[model samples]
Target chain A: MKHIKTLNTRSLQESMKKGGCGECQTSCQ
Target chain B: MVHQYRNNGYNIVLDVDSGSVHVVDDLVYDVIAFLKDDLSKADDAVTARFAGRYSPEEVSEALEEIRALEKNHQLFSRDIYRDAVLDFRNHPTVVKALCLHVAHDCNLACRYCFAQEGEYHGVRALMSYETGKAALDYLVSHSGNRRNLEVDFFGGEPLMNFEVVRKLTAYGRELEKMHDKHFRFTLTTNGVLLDENIMDFCNREMDNVVLSLDGRKEIHDKMRPSRNGKGSYDLIVPKFQKFAKQRKELGKQYYVRGTFTHYNLDFARDVLHFADLGFDQISIEPVVAPADAPYAIRPEDLGTIKEQYDLLAQEMIRREKEGRGFTFFHFMIDLTGGPCVYKRLSGCGSGTEYLAVTPWGDLYPCHQFVGNEEFLLGNVTEGVKRSDLVSIFKSCNVYARKECRDCFARYYCSGGCAANSWNFHQRIDSVYEIGCELERKRVESALMIKAALAD
Candidate 1:
């Protein structure tokens, strides 16, 4: 296993706008 | 021109060109329709239609009212998109995002998965590092001076190709300085393969991470199970909670997205469950399955679905009032800047602003079309063929559909999703009836919430 590294997260406000409908079921689901 | 509908005694008119919505009374409504048909119609013809409803003097006055509406460009307006379409026809299309299907295999066997055992009806495969790199290069070169671009490392399970994802994100970072374009990354996972390293990388470079946990343990385990028939809910919950807390601490965006099927009619419980589990941002959507799929949300489920939406709305409002507000993804209707007609009509960007790449580098309009060759636009090497893309852009928009032209929720819901349209009606432009009803119910719930908030 690779060494686990830490990453920073954007604020919840900034986070809400990301992602796309790259999957099925869940989109309409 | 506009799309108008009579809803509950109110005439809802959506100005197609401007994307403005107007709600008016029966008198104003009938006059607008009459003027829309023929603004030059003599007062007698108007009187003949409404002869018993109103006196001749009233009809004359209504004609004046119609003329006023026309003067304001609210009725009998000229088509605004004709010239705009011609100009765009001469211009080039800019590609902003590529949803790369990095892995076409999954560890879980979700009962309602459209991917067909995670194979997409083809042999399971993982996207090569070279193909992923070329997709980024393709986006940079064809991006047309766009400063911002997006790349979604999507799959039956993106982590199945964890090494490729790690290398791809690193390579994209390296290319950013040289190409002068910013790439926003997102990953959607079922959370079956998330570990310390994968979660770390995802939290670091990935702008968004969609953790698929369908609400409650019982519901999730029942709906989504491992290929070996083992429940995955127990394995994922702790990992997801830890990762989500880290993202929240860093202020990064993430969502716990799940799908509700016919079986989970009380779907709002899923949202409440997320809330109970300390998840603030959530997306609980209805399932999209073949009509005959045993778990499909049937037409009879509409009423309960709607009631559940209302219950969810009430809970959302109560949470906000208590200062513990959480976002239910679908209930998010932009009350400001009504989505433009061109955007609303086309629904999801599909072949226009968005495109999906298969594991082998084949390009389709969106992720849903990866296995379906009929929707193949082109490959990363050749770029999107102009003729093929143009055909999709021209044919897939809501403006091209007849039923959508007069729908009350047309402007808000857009034309609906292309994948759903193709799956339901076998045509890209035709939206599914279930999607339409669900959207209308959501819009209605939103409106109800707005009313309650104002009260």
Candidate 2:
């Protein structure tokens, strides 16, 4: 069960690396 | 003028007009029949010619080509076929096993029972010992060389007629020896009549025993009181606890099932009471009332029952996370993704893959329709052939029903149970009753919620 925490962390890191955190400024005036 | 082309062999009616071809009725059955025939022929050819000539890769490629053909044929309706294939591949046996009502007769009479209604008035009779033996023989012979066999003993109360159960258990052991097969047994009982002798036999022979307990003393007493109007709950509940303890000491697997009717919908809190009694698994089932039973809840009240059941499910899920074993049969759709395949689909080789024999040596589609004349497939004595059983299975296809062809859940739930459909609609293809929708929705919602919570 504790390994699930590591898997989640790895998923989050992969998501961050892939720019899935939505960093594009679409509302720039 | 429109040109209509009907494939009689496939039972598919194709209407081609204006250089466009449109598939009617989803053509599920036609495609299934085609694929089954193609696969069978390919298998036969491979077995005959390539006995030792073809390499493993060649055989795999040949099988893959057949599968691809099935896919191409179902290209227009790919999703349906894909889902069906996934279901089939994941669970080879659409129904893992069956629980049969070998004997309907019971020793004690509970007030809130459905078996006592109408035709069942005479139905509380025992299954002949001959029927029991024939059923075992039918199971062993027809299982298609599948090594493992599973059977569950069910009844108005199974142990009341202990002689038959004991004989069947012993007979099963002998059958296992003769066939060199593994057999597993499970029994569900009311627990009032379960004694030392029964427990000893079960502990040795049976794999698991499920005792029905309905919450605390008062609710159980009021709901399932003995025929004499005495509070049978107090006596039965303690006995259940004692049985669980003895099972633990003797290293036997046992669980308790709590049935919730309209009256005991709020007994979720009392679930822990059974847990405290050292019971491992608690299966909560909603009481099923016969169509004309006086105690039956109205259809409208099913919504309330669902709400109550949802709350219980959440609590049970929490308990499960904490390492306490629990299961609610009502929440089985949640436990197993999608509804029960049997409930969703109408026929899956009923008499072909599974079968039941009545007390008089009459064979039927499963135990539920044993005594009913309509469901009788054939007799064991008169040389029941596989072809006859296949025809019986084919007749249960709900696609023939016009209403079922257009149902929203048609692809998944094939017009509810075959016997129920025939009994109610007088046709297997009619749209299922509202109760079927309500139950499926309830379990589906529960499953969705449970998945979301897990995420």
What is the per-residue lDDT of model 2 for residues B1-455, given as tens digits with 9 covering 90 to 100?
Answer: 11122221112211110111222222332333344424455545653445565555555454554345335342122123223323432332221233456666665566665455112334555666777777677667755556667667777777767898898889989999998766778787887788889888888988888887777777677766666777777777777888888888887777687666667666565566677667766665555555575555557667676666556666666776777756454454322222233333334445544555444456666654666666666775553544544454544544445655534334334445555555566654454464465555543444343443444
> Each candidate's fnat, in order?
0.00, 0.00
Q: Quote the lDDT for B283 in model 2.
A: 63
After superposition, candidate 1 runs with Cα above 4 Å error: A1-29, B1-90, B337-342
The C-alpha local distance difference test score for the whole of candidate 1 amounts to: 0.74
Residue lDDT tens for model 1, B355-445: 8898999888888877887777889998766566556654565566677766767656767887787888877777789888888778666
CA displacement after TM-score superposition, residue B12 of candidate 2 (Å)? 37
Cα-based TM-score, every candidate: 0.79, 0.63
lDDT for B16 (candidate 1): 38
Model 2's TM-score against the true structure: 0.63
Clashing pairs for model 2 are B344-B413
- All candidates' chain B TM-scores are 0.83, 0.66
Worst 10 residues of 2 chain B by lDDT: B13-22
